[model samples]
Target: MSVRARTAIGAVIGATLLAVLPGCGGGTSTGDSGGNSHPKTLTYWASNQGASLEDDKAKLTPELQAFEKQTGITVKLEVVPWSDLLNRILGATSSGQGPDVLNIGNTWSASLQTTGALLPFDDQTFAKIGGKGRFQESALASTGASGKTPTAVPLYSLAYGLYYNKKMFADAGISKPPATWDELVQDGRRLTTGGRYGLAVEGANVSENVHHAFVFAKQHGADFFDASGNPTFTSPGAVEGVKQYVDFIARDKIAAAGNAEYDQNQSIQDFATGKAAMLLWQAAGPNLQKHGMKPDQYGVAPVPVQSGTPGPGQNIDSMVAGINMAVFKNSQNLDGALKFVQFMTSDAEQKKLNGAYGSIPPVKTAAQDPAFSNPELTVLRNTIATSAAPLPQVPKESQFEELVGGAIKDLLADAAAGRPVTTQSVQQRLAKAQQQM
Candidate 1:
């Protein structure tokens, strides 16, 4: 997914009661024709995955050209920014007019699947794109609601990791990276001096807020949803978990107060500029490269845990983060769209695209590249494989991002304003968020 990124949402779209929705294609369907005649063109909405909108367009042109050359189908691509993506998809669902294929944040899969607007990637549909076996298992976990057909196919796979400036660590006389939260706070004190903070955070960024909240909540042994799938946002564990994250600036002071206003990747920029000694991000290699930070200047490690080394249960460190490709059920060029999906997910494209973006490929075969063994990427891979967990996949999960994430934003702002953030206050804010849900 740095600069792989989130937020929550309340259900905004109601399933349209019109013509019956199309079915997933048959076992041998070669891009089933949606209209009277086979289609020749497709409109694709690609998520912004590169340095900028223009950059993503430039990076994807070659792949699009190649796909066109072999398949005789033209793809019209629109690189949409993250801020507008979910709303745009919701708009498409309500209007029934949108691009044939689109990239969705993997976390939105379940919520969007409920709209009945996107085509379900059933067994047969997955076969069209080299089978479900081609993708990583962890990457597949957040595709849709549990125990149902996946609504999308994993595209770029990612997991969060702690990225620390080597020079800062060495300068501070700190040896190894922190393995626990206590050590991190201790090291942070040493690193925070001379106008630089020990850590960086994206406070106003709701998506990232929800992400860290989810990770912290997991570490506190809290789940946003109960066993029966009801939201339990104000639970004691949930409140404590969320408060711990805000405390980076609120109480710990490891991050600067100004960080409370940062969104739009400023936290990443702060780390790259040496204004912050460390960063927690998903596949930040590309973002750092954009800022001209050399690979050797920093080292990657698993995010610090509350207690012991990262593992399952309360030790989980990061949420599975990445993009997924979903075909719109109402596409006029269903066959062409499927072909594009196949072209994009093919082993070659997976390697080329993921390499350019500095992300892990969801396709298993594509990950065998020797390049993935780089020290920075190796840490990310291990975290994703062993410690990363997915956020709740319920329909209201997006709403949680909106409500609770916004609450954190306010809390951080309050901290920046020198207001006291007590446990009672944190619980009150969380209770308000739960009431909204």
Candidate 2:
């Protein structure tokens, strides 16, 4: 099942909601093994995608089998869909029956850390993953806790950029991909005709939808959080950025109708089916492959800059999107779990996994490997090099998503209905949401 369908089902099956808490016992043996001389078995939970979890298991299974042959440690792998991951982890953590190791969405690191269920990646742990210097600086920051310690190790990294269908651009009489904000808006207007939208963006849920808003805010010199991790979305730049987003649907009529009901899947489907000409989305190479598009059929570019911005270079904010691996604090097989994380993030393994799965490696050296041959991947790599920033790792991160996403959704709905979508109204709504945070 898709993540959205599973999330809808999970919401309906409310009885399965898992309770979250802080802390777990340091030394507990849930897996029938005694003290940690050598664990007989270890459990791993992986998030689902086409062949992602399965491919990782397939590639690593040999190593695992070799480890078993060499050291007598058996690894058990469970594939969990994204929707069920939090619930499963929460339930297991609460019952003291969680998997020994799990892959988590990078943004969830801080929230998951609040449960105190994760083992900290101290200096000793860093050495296991080829040292702290192996991973990208932003990826490292995404895994660490604010005012605390690093809670997880970034397993892979992804960033957002402008993806345009070459055919669509040609059909619209556009010569090249947009590089500046005005050009983007003008192209969007030109592309919106004959049942095709100019862009596909998240509009429904806060979690995914806020990604574009965050990027636009960055272009205008506003961020969701300041250096000290306080909410800072009330600035003029932020308001202008958000207003441009809302105006795409409301004023420009360059987005699909009922966008407020859209999510990642819907947006992706729209783009894939040629109903949209452009998409500002996180790395979707895997999805594009599944949809039968060749790399040559599309063009990827850095997000366009805001017009008249005073920055020395183009302002583009790209969200750090990927999964991280965290060992449960209570696991009896901490050493084994840590070893597995180390193996996964190793330069060799990173190249293998990312090459197979169409994801960028979290480790810097692996990303430069010849195996990652796509030009789009190169664009993404360059975007990360210059403009990538970690999402808010605050414990209240989810709340921020809800606030920003909700406000945007309301503004779009109002604008689509030919109602007012003023800067003051958006500012007020955001201010109220900030206060709640």
Candidate 3:
């Protein structure tokens, strides 16, 4: 899932891939494996989703223990902090020493798969876990390069929504949330009074900025990569999409001048503290509660579609987002590792794990449980299936993120500093960014 912490994909691109380890017990498998030759211990690296590592361990250890009892394979669990997880993964990938099974942010799948370090999940391997039909199609499609065998499987699912402050809407004499891009800007203007802004945007956090750029681009009928998997940031539709995003601060003046420095967490804070009327984010309910905002004070809605865009409004929101699990190719216990993956993606475990993290499970049946059937989660779950798109699946996805994200960051800084943000200027910046890639 998209966490509050900033992710570093650059490190992975810079590191060299590790050579395959020899003498590994499990090379490849058919539908299923004969039991391991002897009792085996599996090391698992989990991401920290709770307030602390202790809290995450508290929620996950019981599940791990249950897996051990059911399968007779011991699990060594390590809860890695988000700040350190990427570096650790890169380090392990280079050293050929890492956990048998690990959690990775879905956005990093393509980049990590490029290293030839992860075990690919082919048809037979997928059957070992469960039928591929059990997963949400879009979520499954997000596991790796399109048309190739995926290196991971969706564990938890998440999507972006427009979060609006109900009280602010009422006070501003607005009755409902915006349904189109124009309405969103107009509503933002109406809400801009006193010290509060109509909207909040994360300008400093490159990853967050790039995500918004992707949603807006899709809304305008643009894809970041062509059929041949080449970068297309300079496309007319893509430029228009990003221009509209930057206009929130430059032309509309509904966002604060200093929002250029805000990250996802800061934008969340702005909305929670009533400094902004609306915010675009993904599954921010848990964070809202932590920031002292009551559930009743806010509402969630699908992100507004661009005016005059064709087709239904299902494809104009955030990417089908969340974390996925991958098995290391260099692990000495590939059979046991695959079994652990099966155990983790089981209906029972998906429900338990996603429920603890406040995300929807990837399994359709597990996602349908009453626990996630609430209105808030239902909106995002539907978005994931119908509206969400995957980040570009190129091996150089990290480079795309860095180059595009940096350009947007520069644009935001210029706008925040009261500099010009004309369409021509935006296109020029984007063109420069494309060249860098």
Candidate 4:
């Protein structure tokens, strides 16, 4: 089937069959009741991660109390696992039993927008959340529908970076992380020896693999889409970029063996256990804390640039990613749902929530807050401020990853097996995949 036809069919199925929950219309309101005197309660869904869901509930207890004292509306919060969140939301929305507010991965924005399950935030609502000027422009851009107004608000932001062990660098007599692509390769070679791999890239997880690959493609002056939003993966720059990453693991043999099966967990474990010297990852703070590695033990820096790149000192391509907040279209308390979304994205709330979780604030002012303290976080914040780029917002983005990403993996396997990976073959494979997408 044609890509558009497939996308259309998927949207129809998603919207028509997914379960959606009903919102509370008449209940003992404990928070801001707004102008209307009708009592109401708001249902919220959050992902369970660091800071126990129970603790998140506890943290919000005070805020809920204050909100209730002021407005008399009660907030009911439920924590969902990351694995089940998307499916649950999809089912809930289709069944008309969805929550008033829910969290979603930033990349899922376009897909969710297509379901028509979310309500767009107008200018007035934007103002309530600290206005357009408050958020990182790229993040806000990622929240909107391709040809329409924004469907959700960016709740938090994060970007991928090179995290290295301080002791490993020092032991190798390397005083600093690489500033250029060539230097990174040299460092990787030097670090790879005696049962330790030089780097851990998410080579197996197609979604993550493509995310980092796009960062490299950007540094090489290529993008997944052209000015008209058509797929552009056949570009010479993109092909070269993909080769560079594949070569690191295959030709150079500097990445962990069996990397083809490595997911985010494998990469994280390799880095945390010192089996790998460096990892390109997003928001490693929580994981580091869990592993007992403090700031002083690790160093964070932007991904290095190729030797000859245009427009910058080091052509850093910050891979930005995060979750957005959305309210279902069938929601009974539309105004109340919007208000809750507004509260979550508000500058004050962004600061509090991001601070609690070590996430980069989505808002410009919140990102600049002095209280946002963490050495690694500071590096990430600075990188996002000057170099971040959004992923392709195409509705078929997920499908493209599955298709082209599989081709890249095949190329990697070929190269690792000492088989030639020709540019012509790569181009043919990618072109075919583009047609499929």
* Alpha carbon lDDT at 304, candidate 3: 78
Clashes of each: 8, 0, 1, 27
Off by over 4 Å in 3: 1-5, 11-39, 308-315
Ranking of all candidate structures by their TM-score, best first: 1, 3, 2, 4
| True lDDT of residue 61, candidate 2 | 68
**Models, CA RMSD each:** 3.6, 4.0, 4.0, 5.9
lDDT per residue as tens, model 4, 1-437: 00000011122223333333333222122234343343367777776544355766766667666666655667777777554566666666555556767776676676566566677667876776557677787687678556677777887787767899889999999999887778888898999999998888666566666776787788778877887768988898778777777777767777865776664366777888888898877777677766767768788887677764322322656666777777765555667776676677667877887777667788777777887756778777766667776677766564566676677777777766667767777777778877876
What value does the lDDT take at residue 401 in candidate 3? 75
Q: How does each model score on lDDT?
A: 0.83, 0.72, 0.80, 0.68
Error of 1 at 429 (Å): 1.2
Best lDDT goes to which candidate? 1
Report the C-alpha lDDT of model 2 over 1-437, residue by residue, as the tens digit: 11121121123112322255567622244355456754777787777644355655676667667657755668777778665676676666566777888877777677667778888888877887678888888788788566678889887777777889999999888999887767888899899888888987667656555766877787777878877778887888778888888888877778876766775467777787788889876666667756776667778887777764222233765777777888888888877777778777878778876766667897988888977657778877777677777678877565576677677877877876778888898898778867866
Q: Estimate each model's TM-score.
A: 0.94, 0.87, 0.90, 0.83
Model 3 pairs in collision: 1-323
Q: After superposition, how far is residue 161 of candidate 4 from its true place, in Å?
A: 1.5
**Winner on lDDT (1 vs 4):** 1
